[model samples]
Target: MTDFITTELHTARCLLRPWRTEDIPLVPPIADTRAISWNTSLKFPHPYGEEAARTMVSWSQADAGVDKWQFAVFKDGQLIGGCGTIRGEDVHAHTAVVGYWLGVDWWGRGIASEILAALVDYMREETDIEQLTATCFGWNPASRRVLEKAGFRNEGVRKGVVKKWGKTTDLWVYGMLL
Candidate 1:
């Protein structure tokens, strides 16, 4: 198991905190209403209601003591999204994968970018990690742009790389060296 660093991070208009039970109310709608599940690896039952939220919160806390780090993104004092770093093998432990999504209503407001910036800075200051990577569906230009604005460079695309919602899709890889 890998160890993770946890901290409260702030952005110009948002606050990023560890997940809590209070976040359940926001997760379902955000997960269900938005087209968010299409481009990411979230399970189909996302916005997974109260029971799922409880399980996730508990799982996240347990993972934190090892290698996974997840944070709830808040704006106006309300949970609006989430961000996290997932650990890989020991040889690549100094590196992490990044993933996040915001509520559909919050789109185009630069919230994801704000959270990404904070996450990057937090990793640089709090860990030995020197690189962060992200992957997006080939069709998600908006997500590609977010990564670019956050200082990630496009590496390349892998053909038929992901099978989401029962169909195979290509994936674009992005990377940022800290």
Candidate 2:
């Protein structure tokens, strides 16, 4: 199993903490939009609801502050987004995949950029991971921008590798070494 470094981190305008059961009630209202799910991942489908939130929170609750790296992003004590890492095992144990998402209402405020930078700094300082990776669909320039602003390099792209919403799209991969 992979080990995580910390449970909580703070950016200038957000507080990132481990997921809580209480957050189950807050997730759907912010995460159920097609706009978010379409660009994020298949795991987070449109119309995401309490059950998905329960699973996400439960997956992190037991491992919070110790083993799991995913965090719930909060602004002024309200759940606004999430950011975290998934560490690789076996020969890739020194690397991790990073991801983050925010509610639609909060877009374009530099929040994700700030949070991503802070998460990268935290991982570099607190974990054994040597490399960090992030990916965005070809249509997601906003996500690409966030990753680039966090000092990640556009390592490469895989054309037509992602099929989402019945359409094939490219995948842009970014990486940073700590």
Candidate 3:
């Protein structure tokens, strides 16, 4: 529960750093795809616009430096996606839920898997979190694969856990206990 400096996290393909005010404009274009929103939680809305971008950036900026757990993913100086961790409180404070997304153009390039593995390692080595978890829509096999490749084990599945786009779906939960 004490502060630990995070600075920037890096993978072979990209850099994960704190969000900036300038990134607000760049998010809408990359995040406005139904394909991306379909697999993610409702928090990431389809037709993602400037207002949503502003909210995302504000959340990242509100936290302390390097310690800002949310990160903007950049490759070659351009924003390509984003990732972050949400730590649980109370009895689950040692656990953190992880999430990430890449632009459609960045898909099939293994960027998410690469950055995700790195993020897990960073959190394990740099922070107080001891358990990391991620959940994907059961129909999203690609995301399930990414989580597996990053060393997460499928914990279980919860049926009727997510209602998105007017359809109810199962949620596949994955976790890594460090």
How many backbone clashes can be found in candidate 2?
A: 0
User: Looking at candidate 2, what is the lDDT of residue 84?
Assistant: 88
lDDT of candidate 3 at residue 48, scale 0 to 100? 96
Decoy 1 TM-score against native: 0.88
- Give lDDT: candidate 3, residue 45: 91
Tell me how candidate 1 scores on lDDT: 0.79
Tens-digit lDDT string for candidate 1 (90-167)? 799878899888878888888888899998887777766778999999878899989999999999999998876678
Clashes of each: 2, 0, 0
Residue 156 in candidate 3, Cα distance off native in Å: 0.3
**Superposed Cα RMSD, model 2:** 2.5
Q: What's the lDDT for residue 132 in model 1? A: 90
Give each model a TM-score: 0.88, 0.93, 0.93
Q: Per-residue lDDT tens digits of candidate 3, residues 1-178?
A: 3343346877887998877888999999899999999989888998899999998888777754333478899999899999888888789888888999999999989999999987887787878888998999977999999999999999999998989888998999999998
Which residue pairs in candidate 2 collide? Answer: none
